[model samples]
Target chain A: MIGEWIRFGITCLLLIAALVGFTAAVIGAYRFGFVMNRLHAAGIGDTLGIFLVICAVSVSSGSFLEAAKAFLIIVFLWFTSPASSHFLSQIEYYTNPHLYRYVDRKIQDGPHSDEKEPE
Target chain B: MSVETAYDYLYTGALIWLSVLILFMLVRSIMGPRITDRLLAINMIGTLVISCIAVLSRLLDESYLIDAALIYAMISFVSVLILAMIYIPVRQTRGKFEKDARKEIRAERGIRGSVTESGSPEYKAGKEAEKPAYEKGNAGLDNGRDTQQDASLQEKGGSRT
Candidate 1:
């Protein structure tokens, strides 16, 4: 019974952490001024938030097949999230006419360029 | 309370919190100024929904919902890719139109000897605005050499405009 209680406590804590991650992601998405910054914020929920939630569920599940399935979801997301983010970033790079205003192009020329560092 | 009951309460609380987060993401999607912003929000929403479904699978003791969550993840990824494929060409045409307009203005200015007026703030700003697109186009060309997908898109964009 003591061991079961400990497991329950750990599961609840993990879920709470996931909830906090999702909350932060949502808030950051809304607060960030630039699309690139917003993408960075949304990525938190995509990777860490879901990973924590799935971990919590798997812990409570206590069955080999269920835990394996939960881990599979994490693996699948880890692979796909970067692909989707890359596509989205490409779309942003091509579509936004004002993108150069937000992003520094001088950085592209090489880190050792003659451009004066911003103070 | 019993361990089972405590677990139930925890799951319910998590579901409520995730639902609220989903709603917030929905608002972000609606308020996004750019198509990419909206698409990003939608992608995040899909992720949140998957987590919700996963939690629901255990909470409701319905093992099959896990399969549904897996399917949802696959569909979400494909949808984003398809949307991107459609969006790129439209943006390319729009960019071409803008570039043509800028060229016409530059030609008119050159005829008026405004090329010597590059010291003016407006001309300087316009040049600054043009630089990024030029750089991006060159970068796209470089990428085109590396990837057939980009090369094909460039070809289609060139043919359309």
Candidate 2:
């Protein structure tokens, strides 16, 4: 009985975290533009939060096969996030030098500062 | 969503925090000036993303997040290598450029182009000083060549006689 109660309590916690993460992601996306901050927010607001929620769901579902599937989705996302982000950043950095210009970064102290002077 | 266990709550809380962390990394990456700085931030984001999926799986009472984490790790590693390959040539070329510039400056100042040519890059070694060593070396080479010509002419003349 105690075990069952504990399980229920845990499920509630996972649901709440998921709700928060999802909310944060949406907010970040809305405020920062889909590509600008969506990926960033997803890193923490979606991916990590989702992982926690999945664990909770798996344990609660009490089905090995179903739980495994949830775990797999989380795993897939985990692997893809870094690879995609790296590639995205590389593309932005090399092909589109304009990202720096639009990002509001302070290049004053950087080596590129010399080039930053009013053209 | 019957999260009926301590694992559920712990996993949920963990996921929330992971998402928070990944967001930070993402911002860092976007703001970075250098390639590696962005890459490092991206790497951190990937790790956090992996962690997020893992936690989300628990919260959602599923088990798919693990696969995502593994894939993220593999892909990120490969991507970083690609970035390095793209920039390596640029770095090498700049090094060569600096060497060439210094060489030209040294030559202008009456110094040798390379350290192997002699020593020191002190280019402004005084204008047109006409060093004794320069005259001596030129004179020696000229004298040797003249002697060789004279000997050859003398040898030809004696043969004809």
Candidate 3:
């Protein structure tokens, strides 16, 4: 009975930590000035928040199969989240004409060099 | 309370909080300024929902819900990938069109300037203004110096008279 209570305590703590992570991500999404900055914030929730929640579930579920499946979810997300962030950043770079206003970029010798030409 | 009851209460409270967070993310996506911002919010919403599912799985003593969350993760990742793919080409083509239009306008402006030799004063002024004063080889400074010299010369001439 005491062991069960101990497990319950740990689960509750993990759940609270996950909730805090999600709350921070939400606040960051709202408060960040740029899309890239917001992406950084979202990454926090994607990684730490989900990890904690799954950890809690795995601890409380007490079944090897469920724990294994939870582990799979974590692995999948760990691999894919960075890829999605990269793609999102690429979209921001290609779409935003004013990206230089936000990020420092070296002007390469190409069509981009003609930006200062009077039109 | 029994461990079962305690677990039930904890999971229930967690699910409720997760739902609230998801609702907040939904509003963020709706209010997001850029396409990336909306996509980011959607991604976060997917993550929150996955956690909710994981919690629910434990609450209900079911393992299939974990599988459901896994599938949800895969789908969300693919959705972001596909949407980004769709948007990039469209943005690139639109950028190409704008660039072409700008090149045409520049060519036209060049032709007019060469043929007339005295192109529109406003256009000339705009072009001049596009360059910084320092890059103009200190022309304003030179003018100021010249005016000062002329003023001194006039004062000397007046004194001599």
Candidate 4:
């Protein structure tokens, strides 16, 4: 009975942590000034927040099948989040005519070229 | 209260908190200035909903809801991708039209016939200074061999950076 109580406590802690992450994400998304900044904020909920919530649910679920399914959601999101973020940023870059005014870009000589190296 | 009853209360509180967060994200999406802003808010909403569903799966002891959450994640990802794909080509063609108009203006002025090799070095330098650094790198890559199409393709790569 004690073991079950311990597990329950741990699950509660994880869920609380997840809740905090989502709350922070929402706050950040609202507070940030730029679209790129907002994307950074939203990413918190996409990766860490979802992962924690799923972990909490999986811990409460004693069945191996259910836990595995929960784990799969995290894995799938790990791949999808970056892809979506990339495409969204691409959309922003291409569509925004005055993007250069807001975003600073640094030009380097080549991929292998270092800042210290002289031309 | 019994431990199970306490757990139930905790779950209920979490659900209410997540629901509030979702509403906040919805407001952000509506008030956002750009398409990307709205898309990002929508993406976040999807994530919050997934978490809510996962919690519900545990709270209600319904295993099928987890599957529903998984499907929701997949659909959210695809929707973002699809929206991006739809927007990109339209932006590119609009850029092409502007380039053509600039060329026509130059032709009428008897300044230059071709898009390539026309601008003076000072003009080129000033234009390069105005452009974003990544665009300057892309312009450098636009050498004698490739045409405007290749240059535009290289510009697409600039967005990734």
Off by over 4 Å in 1: A104-119, B90-161
TM-score of each: 0.73, 0.38, 0.71, 0.71
Give per-residue CA lDDT, model 1, range A1-119, as digits (tens). 99999999889899899988888888888877667777888886669998998899898888989888888889999999989998898887677654543334443554344332222
Q: Report iRMS values in order.
A: 3.7, 11.3, 4.4, 3.4
Tell me the tens digit of each residue's lDDT in model 4 across A2-88.
888899899999999999888888888877666777788788666889988989998888899999999999999999998888888
- In model 3, residue pairs whose N, Cα or C atoms come closer than 3 Å (at least 3 residues apart or on different chains), thus clashing, are none
Winner on DockQ (1 vs 3):
1
Cα lDDT, model 4, residue B143: 22
Off by over 4 Å in 4: A104-119, B90-161
Worst 10 residues of 4 chain B by lDDT: B140-149
RMSD per model, one decimal: 9.6, 16.2, 11.5, 9.7
User: Which of the CAPRI classes, incorrect, acceptable, medium or high, describes model 3?
Assistant: acceptable
CA shift of B30, model 3, Å: 0.8
Ranking by DockQ: 4, 1, 3, 2
Residue B67 of model 4: what lDDT? 98
Q: For candidate 1, give the DockQ.
A: 0.44
Please identify model 3 stretches exceeding 4 Å from their true place. Answer: A104-119, B90-161
Model 3 chain A weakest lDDT span, ten residues long: A101-110
lDDT of 1 at B159: 73
Error of 4 at A11 (Å): 0.8
